[model samples]
Target chain A: MTTKFTPDHEYIRVEGSTGIVGITPYAQEQLGDIVFVELPAVGKALKKGDEAAVVESVKAASEIYAPVTGTIVEVNSLLTNEPGLVNSDPEAAGWMFKIAISDASELDTLLDADGYAELTL
Target chain B: MAEVPTEDLKHTPLYERHVTAGGRIVPFGGYALPVQYPTGIMTEHKWTRDNAGLFDVSHMGPGFLTLNTPSGDAETDHAAIAAIIEPLICGDIAGLKPGQIRYTLLLNESGGALDDLMVARSKTPGTLFIVVNAGTKEGDFARIAAAAGNKATLKRADDNALLALQGPEAVNVMAALVPPAADLGFMQFGEFDWNGTPVTISRSGYTGEDGFEILAPAHMSVALWDELLTDPRVRPIGLGARDSLRLEAGLPLYGHDLDETVSPIEADLGFAVSKRRREAADFPGAQRILAERDGKLSRKRVGLLVEGAPAREGAEILDALGTAIGVVTSGGFAPSLGKAIALGFVSPEHTAIGTKLQVSVRGRSQPAEVVPTPFVPHRYFRKSV
Candidate 1:
């Protein structure tokens, strides 16, 4: 139940064949306030590195990329009402979606906690 | 292929403090200012609305003006200075009692606004303190100097730094530092000493709140800022929250809402032009401004509650039938109102509140309606002593 982070600040925690994906705390901190979260629709297929969501802050807008290829199964509905959760707990409670992994091998491309921290620094 | 140095971006004196507080620094008005801190802009914004927020407005220009004549008498200097500057602005400078402040606009000969500034007649006799925008200060000074024509002396207060302590709880935090600040009503300024350093504190702010703006010597600014942050009610806010706060208040930013091509009458700021000044018709563009006031204006500034998505600056505003009517001067998602709002100058025919309109953003037309300003009501303190 450990999450892997991408150098770009996305986190992927695998649960069986499906993985929950969201941005890391570092990413949310850099983005400032999260005003809007444009999540991918359920059942939409995504490729590794493909844009999965758009997070708009008061200062800027950035695209959230998929860390592993899969089809989106569920999205975080809570973001619509309280986007600040992303800043509050970006990797855990702020997970954007659950995706059925189409290619488990894509997980190798992401970094572990230590590697992600180094990349951010 | 060359990497730019971090110093290439401008930094204010409190840059280190912002970074230490986990603030996200961003380029704004040519300086690297904190946009928000770790708590995030929304929380920071809401916190300011409910509590108190300290803003580093040091980049703003604070300067003084005095009569050019060497009369050596404060009373004579005050009369000469007021008379000389009154004809150039829309406000009744002569009527400005000591310690009184007035918001006025500098106009071009063609009836366009050069800049909107705050002018405060000092209680120390003969001195008028003015605050102008950071981005447009240089041009504003040049224009003011040229208009003064050796009749007044304009001295830029480079040694001073400005800070805004805003929100409902601002008075509580500031009252501890300067006891008399709680008694001053909105738009009123007075001199006080903080730890032996003289300061000018005004009960006015860009945010629609009961707050105070403090101007002190640059060296003393950091000390005062540190002292204020000790209060649990006061947290440092950055430019991000500042923008949303002002937007919710529906205040016009100089370059965006009021510009060289926009006249006061057309910008819905005719109130700033007093009846005496209007009748005198001696200020620059007075004739054209008065004509516009008399219903001769073709376009007028109006507020818009945009539907669909946020329409940003330069977005084209359209009439009900889809014809271009105006352009959005300032538009954003108002954190306080929880909706997208915009300010623009639509044709006079379409300026009525509730008038249906459309705004084109990124090639998409979104429905909008003309609305009144200050998306949020101003909560300035009014002491009934």
Candidate 2:
């Protein structure tokens, strides 16, 4: 699996044509303790950078954008009752949704791990 | 969150300490203060409820109003000082016992609140200590100073660092640092010597916790802060937790829950309108304020227990039939309760406790119900007589 990130700090891990999307650890850290997460429903179509979900911390709310255009195949239901998972394990079990890639070429426009690391720094 | 360029923001004395401690600096009230430390708002908030939370509230306006000329008789001097300020607010400053603090509202000519503030009768017979909100300091000070005219002088002390050590263990920390200050009853304040420098400490705080607010010289502030943090029970809390704590405490923040256009009665702060001031009908906007008190008010502020996603500021409040009633002033997740809560104004008829309501978040209506606030009970320390 290859992981790519957006300048807004969302990460999409791709396995074949399917991609799992979630906010990066750095993004969660900046956002502080997660109190609530509002996710898009399954079967929803999203364009690149569309506001796909909302992550709320104790102080404020932030939007999580889609990394690339695709159709949402699944959403992390665990977040409904356990939002803190995003703060504790943002990259793994905290994954927000799964999207089926509609345009493979869009993945090439996302930043690589090295590029995202430099951007955060 | 929108970033305010650091170059344009003023730095508090604790700015460097916050940075060194891994605090996320943010612009608030025109100052560069920490929104949260590395431990985050939830941890800092819970730590405060369970232990002690040290906060830098220096951005607030703390000042003294002293009679320009005291006649040497304590009562006469106090009356003279109080007379100069009573016209500007709805609190009976003249009735305050020495060293006692009263929360009061600064009202405009129309009876709308200009700002809510704390006014204290200083032990020094001719002086009064006042603290106003940070965002409204400049205008508030100017107004107070102008109102004082030649009879009294409003001495601005915003340059001083104001620290609040709050929580259940706050008194214990103070007892160890300054023994005399710990004996103060809730809402009382006194000047004490901290080592060599003089410090004014009040047995009061915004958090619904037993705590103290200390006003100390800027140069000695860092040393005092370092000394306090040495206590294992004390942690440096940021503005993020401070906001949550006050929200749970059901306190109306100056700019959000309160504004220049909100009257004391409409804002659910009628208690701040002193009985003496009400009877005399001498405070600003007394005519309108008294009318509102007598059931002429249209809307009233109420607390809501929201289900599902947090309803943020500007969210619409709706009735059971899905008709809009009002707008939320302040809404967020209450760390102490583990649920979303909000403060909003709705038609007076719909404000009774347990009234079913709804809040539109992102165009979707969510279940909400009117509930008594101080979402968590206030644990202020009141000494038993």
Candidate 3:
């Protein structure tokens, strides 16, 4: 599985044509305690940079955008009850949704592990 | 988010302490203050509820309104000072016993709240210790000074550092640091010496917990802060936790839950209108205020239990039919309750406890219900009579 990241801190881990999405650990740290998470419907299609979800901290609400154009195949309903999972395990169990990649070429435009590391720096 | 120019913001005396403790600094009311420490707001909020939380609140305006010339008699001098300030607010200042504090509102001509403030009668006579919200301090001070004219003086004490130590263990912490403060009843204040420096200690705070608000010299702020943190029960909390704590307490924040256009009655602070002021019909906007009290009011502030996402300020409140009825002024996640809650103003007909309501959050209607507040019960230390 190869992972790609957006400058806005969203990450998409590709396994074949399916990609799992979530915020990076750095983004979760800056957002503080996650109190609520609003996810898109399972069948919703989102373009790159489209607001796909919302994460609310104790202080304010922040929008989470889609990293690449795709159709949402699944969403993490566990986030509704345990939003802190984003803060605790952002990459694995905290994955917000599973998307069916429509254009494989779009993944090439995202930052790779080394590129994302430098962008954060 | 745009970065607020730090150089332009005023720094409190404990600014260095906050930075050294790894606090996340933010601009609040034109002051550079910490929003949260490294431990985060959730932990700090829970700490304050369960133990003692030390907060730096020096940005608030604390001043003394004193009579220029005292009559030498306590009662006469107090009456003289009270008369000057009474015309501006709806509180029975003259009736306050020495060292007693009353929460009151500074009103505009049309009965809207200019600012909410604390006024206390001094034991020394002819002086009233007043504290106003930080954002409205400049205008509030100017207005009070103009009212005093040559008869009294308003000494601004915003330069001093103000600290709040709050929670169930607050009294125990004060008992160890300042023995006399432990005896103070809720809403009472007194002057005490801390390591030879005189400080004012009030047995009150915004958090729904037993606590004390201390006003000390700027130079002694660091030493005092370090001294308090030495106590295992005390933790340094930031403004983020402060806001959350007050919200859970059901207290109104001056700028958000109250403003120049909101009246005391509309803000659910009608209790601040003293009985004597209501009877005399003498305070500013008394006619409108009294009329509102008599059922001429249109909307009322109510607390709500939100079902889904937290309904932040400006979120629209809807009736059962999804018709707009009001707007939320303050809403967020309640750490103690582990659920979303909010304070908002809605038409009087829709404010009854248990009334079903909805909040439109980001174009989605979330289920909500009118509920009684102090979402967490207050644990004030009211001494038995």
DockQ of 3: 0.77
Enumerate clash totals for all models, in the order shown: 0, 0, 0
Candidate 2 on B1-385: residue-level lDDT in tens? 4455788999888788989998888889999999888898999999999999999999999999999889999999999999988999999999989999999999999998889999999989899999999999999999999999998999998899999999999999999999999999999999999998899999999999999999999999999999999999999999999999999999999889998889999999989999999999999999998999999998899999999999988999999999999999999999999999999999999999999999999989999999998899999989753
lDDT of 2: 0.94
Could you give candidate 1's per-residue lDDT for residues B1-385 as a string of tens digits? 1123456676666777888998767767677788788787888899999999999988887888876664877667677777766766788877777777889987778878888889888876677888888888888888777767878789997447788999999998888989987788888898988889989899899989999999888777778889999999999998888988998888999889888889999999999998888877888898888899999998898999998457778999999999998999888778887778889988899998899999996576989999888898999987643
- Span of 10 residues, lowest total lDDT, candidate 1 chain B: B1-10
What stretches of model 1 exceed 4 Å from their correct place?
Answer: A1-21, A40-52, A65-75, A97-116, B1-6, B9-11, B70-76, B319-324, B360-367, B383-385
DockQ of each: 0.29, 0.81, 0.77
Candidates in descending TM-score order: 2, 3, 1
User: Which lDDT value does model 2 have at A6?
Assistant: 92
Encode model 1's per-residue lDDT on A1-121: one tens digit a residue: 6678877778999999899989887787677767777788999999988989878777555788898899999999999877778888887788899999998888877798889888877
Query: Per-residue lDDT for A37-87 in model 2, tens only?
Result: 999999999999899999999878899999999999999999999999999
| Deviation in Å, model 2, residue B189 alpha carbon | 0.4
Each prediction's fraction of true contacts recovered: 0.31, 0.79, 0.66
**Candidate 2, true inter-chain contacts retained:** 0.79
Show where candidate 2 strays beyond 4 Å. B1-3
- The estimated TM-scores of all candidates read 0.86, 0.99, 0.98
